[model samples]
Target: MHEIQDPLFKPFALGGLELPNRIVMPPMTRSRASQPGDVPNELMAEYYAQRASAGLIISEGTWISPLGKGYAWTPGIHSPAQVAGWRKVTGAVHAAGGRIFAQLWHVGRLSHTRLLDGRSPVSSSAIQATGVNVYVAERDGTPGFVQASTPRALATDEIPRVVDEFRQAARNAMAAGFDGVELHAANGYLVNQFIDSNANDRTDAYGGSLENRLRFLGEVANALVEGTGDKGRVGIRLAPLTTLNGCSDDHPEITYIAAARLLGEIGVAYVHIAEADWEDAPHMPVEFKQQLRAAFPGALIYAGKYTAERARAALEAGWADLIAFGRPFVANPDLPERLRIGAPLNAHDRATLFGGAAHGLTDYPTLAGSAA
Candidate 1:
């Protein structure tokens, strides 16, 4: 039998970025960016910099355009202020000897009119997203769900402009000194909407066949690669099995594998796959993941309720190149230290997961500091 090494402690090269370990901090929206339009702030910078010990930190989903926003307080990369704010974040992370990547996003129908710059939201189809957006709030300090604003399907003529937004966002990320950028093509967002049959009912070239359905995504990926100039500096993330927050598709396995094959052909740096987030929702089935692994020939990062032991298993099994920790890294800023020393893991507080200040965000202590 071949001896399998622990991927958790292994050094891997993601394009030009060298990660000391295979532990990645997957992008999680904190909803803490400045409101009106989620501009990156000092607090956000501190929050990410504090957790810089992870091998690679992928910043939270940031809108590439104002029309792409769907959540309150989530950051954007479309404006000068937002770009400046991100420069501060990258500077801090780089100062701390950490590598960071920005995840460019567009919420699509997952938004309400309140979140859009104007009262208009856009999608591949004129459908409303099925679930509630937790970011939109009521008058008092309580969480409420609003009906998703009706979305206007993207006209074939307008598709090129949408593709351009991704290209510009990638350029902006590099300008801000990020190591690279990840296209948020998963989680039923704008790109995902175009891939899902139920959400995309267009009759044009970008709609009917599988090739057409995947055209927008392919263009977006091609644009990012072209924008980056170096293939090793770009990655993409997909949630092919997420059935949460009102997201679903006809055949995720076939849809996503074909998508991965295309990315592999383009020679992307990496592909982050979120198997399943919601506890009750079905995860990326083992068979499906095997198929995706077979289809994609890049550094593969897996996220979703993963334990260090499981991460090791995945690496040993050759199923994943990296394991991304979400809530674990949130509570244990010294996650790499804890893993290295076999220290106890910190319990994450669910109450303060979103829409809050420093308590659960920045107050988590490192092992060395906590013991002292």
Candidate 2:
């Protein structure tokens, strides 16, 4: 197939935005925000601007508040400084003719007191995600990783306030010049904690049955819509089958199919599904994909370790409207162009993947430079 004829290069309408291609740069936490306040810095701005060739750029998981933070150096949207810091990033992307979205996130049970100012993390249930470690700042001001502490379940009345945090964060994202907002409701974060049955063991209205488990996500989705005043500019991400952060459900298809239907009914712009990408990961059944398409009317984005051929096949089969490239985008700033021309891609350095300087962040050579 001709490179131009590849489905990945085709244009598509994503809500109010008309993307030039179906290639998306999904959010990946690099943990490089400025110290003392977890502020987005010029380095981060430059990093994103370098990859502005993507059809849509979703910024790293940004904490909505101090309570939402799960790792050291991850940016936040709750403070004025953080907002100003991200503004530069959004401005940079827009100047390069790209659209960006802020991914609002809260780590829930996947957090430690060291990251939460000595307070226990909050979740739907008082459960500790065993065997999970989060990045943190050591006592000597060095970067380190620590096991997640046990979490305290949110009080029944506290749910509303938690929802409000998402609302406020959405407003902040818009103020920071984001084209839209994507709720980070996957990967065993706070919203994922509520959705997964294994993590949410409460008997309250926010737990037990699947419907109750969905209430938190629904409320948060609604809050983001209300805050943005435009449902078309809001989106949600879900990982129904992922056990990345100790999140699991008895019936992932049932849980996520219903969730997709709810998001479709709410009129969000898109639904991003983060597929399991690890070696030996279980395949997402074809039946589930068809059911999800029927349930959601908006754009559907699938991301994992998708090769160019696999992405084209998914688009050709009408299973996904867009394809997101995560790690590949990390090393190839001009990923769409690289994929278009079948150029060699730089392998990402695992050691410098997180909490790094410019060595692996913005220093990757582009096709033009490499040819020279």
Candidate 3:
């Protein structure tokens, strides 16, 4: 085994899993899953296995249920076919000796009527999310964004099913040969709906008080742990100060602090935090980020606008245990080696990011590989 000499290449443990370095390939939605329902495909296997040089790979957000899907062509972990599809992916990655995890997600109110089951996306309240769903199409073969529709509050009885969805997804992930699973409780998804006061205005056990609001997330995490059987293998992603897709909560400091502490108590493998949605995030102050670092008390993974240099700084500063590179990894399959040798990075093609063939997906070149 080659020992990493760069401070950024240092080995660390997220629970029982030992990473080769501190680099992480965060989840990026490619929308390439097979049509109708999101199912992993051979292309996905080739894409992920090609990038296995990273310390850890967190797969794109996979819907825990059909209703959890908010966009077109995203993958799901709910069905046997999906499981079989992912098995090909995991098998390829494992054959290359790469560690990977699946991120379980629910879009909550982000879904449009056109995207939902019977045109209903259940959330914590009836509030319409802020900002435009950027993926919406317009007339005349153009594209435009529009305000989100009002979401229905999930009934108290239906909440358990939501938790169960995550549990079952974790089970399916393991069965499909993933090393573990990560809960997509961040980024204004279903779990975030319950955490954000503006989104979750319920008068029931799942809302109001902080404890009540975090109840579903707690259940989901615990259930995933029980299902996956390796606490150190499971991870959770949280955007504590995200404003994208109109996600903002009152008392973010308190809510996130409490959440980090609670997640620590539950013994998850890692906590993936998107420091801020944007590069220069005005929402998350340094003090709040510091507080989260202190409260989380687990393997900390930070993603968003990070370079290898910044990743090294984060590790040296002890603010992040792992650094997840999003766009860089998208265009560079051998990202870790590129950073190791200070090579020029290929810029990602925005046009081909969402739905495309291997033209922009798996065709990115590595230093030693063909540039075809």
Candidate 4:
């Protein structure tokens, strides 16, 4: 009998880069940037470099500007120091022979005044992200999660300036020696605040209709595509059914399908769909997956709670071109190698998931380093 192939190890061609495997390290916020400037540091570089076995590594969500930030200690791409800091990260990953992309992010409404330099958070509407909290420093200067403050609605004229922020952030990513940039349009952040129905009640050119809601996404996608000098170098992450950050839609199916088709029309390189991961989260309909596949011409990446069997099944079924593992990569920096050999994986420390030293960040021993 012939040796069976492992689907997870299959090579994928992403734009000009040839990915060595199908395992992707999706963006996850660790809030570990250096203080005083929210800059990426050598510790962050070591964390990413340790996981270089991944086919493609998408860095943590990086704020595009100070006004776009919603969390304390998260890195930004707009400042010269920030760019130089990210250079260390990209150089480390590349030195380890890994391809990485910077995730450009803007948390529109999911912010506190403390995180915004006393400025109210801005969003598509003046709505509070009830029941949600963001990382902020207390009066004593200790960092903690606080109830998100209500956001002010962005004026129609202010939208373009926000788009330009993302455009410039992409240029900064290139300057930082990154291979590409991924727009964090997913979750309940800034872009989602605009795309979701309840979060947006504006009647301007950017709201009140499906086409209007998509205008911001389209403009930003175009800006990243044009700014980066390659349509294939740009990717988008979208969350259609997630309500984690107080964002909801009356009709997610219709809205997202139209969004996917618009992205296809714009000739983007990939679209990453973040499947809801809550304990009782509803299953994503097979029909919607097929529709997304038909609508977007490039690669499709899906991230959620996934096992190797389920991931292989999804790839065999043909909707997802790449599968991203979040926590798995956290505890198992050599995750791809471990999976290939069917080795046991390490458990991640929940307490150290964010804002910590290297103890939980980069101390996970690899298969060879651990005892049997």
Ranking by lDDT: 2, 4, 3, 1
Looking at candidate 1, what is the lDDT of residue 77? Answer: 96
Off by over 4 Å in 1: 1-5, 35-37, 137-144
How accurate locally is residue 218 in candidate 4, as Cα lDDT from 0 to 100? 97
Candidate 3 residues 164-242, lDDT tens each?
A: 8888899999999999999998888888988888778899998899999899889989999988988887899998888
User: Mind giving the per-residue lDDT tens digits that candidate 2 earns over 244-264?
Assistant: 889999999999999999999
The per-residue C-alpha lDDT of model 4 at residue 331 equals 96
Worst 10 residues of 1 by lDDT: 1-10
The pairs that clash in candidate 3 are none
Q: Could you tell me every candidate's TM-score relative to the true structure?
A: 0.95, 0.98, 0.94, 0.97
RMSD of every candidate to native, in Å, equals 2.4, 1.7, 2.3, 1.6
Task: Give the better candidate number (1 or 4) by lDDT.
Answer: 4
Deviation from native of the Cα of residue 344 in model 1, angstroms: 1.6
Clashing residue pairs in all predictions, respectively, total 0, 0, 0, 0
Candidate 3, position 82, lDDT:
95
- Which digits, one per residue and each the tens of the lDDT, describe model 1 over residues 131-206? 5553676677445667777788877888899899999999999998899999998888999888877778888988
List, residue by residue over 55-163, the lDDT tens digit for candidate 4.
Answer: 9999999999988898888999989999999999999999999999999999998988888878999999999999998878656755788899989999999999999
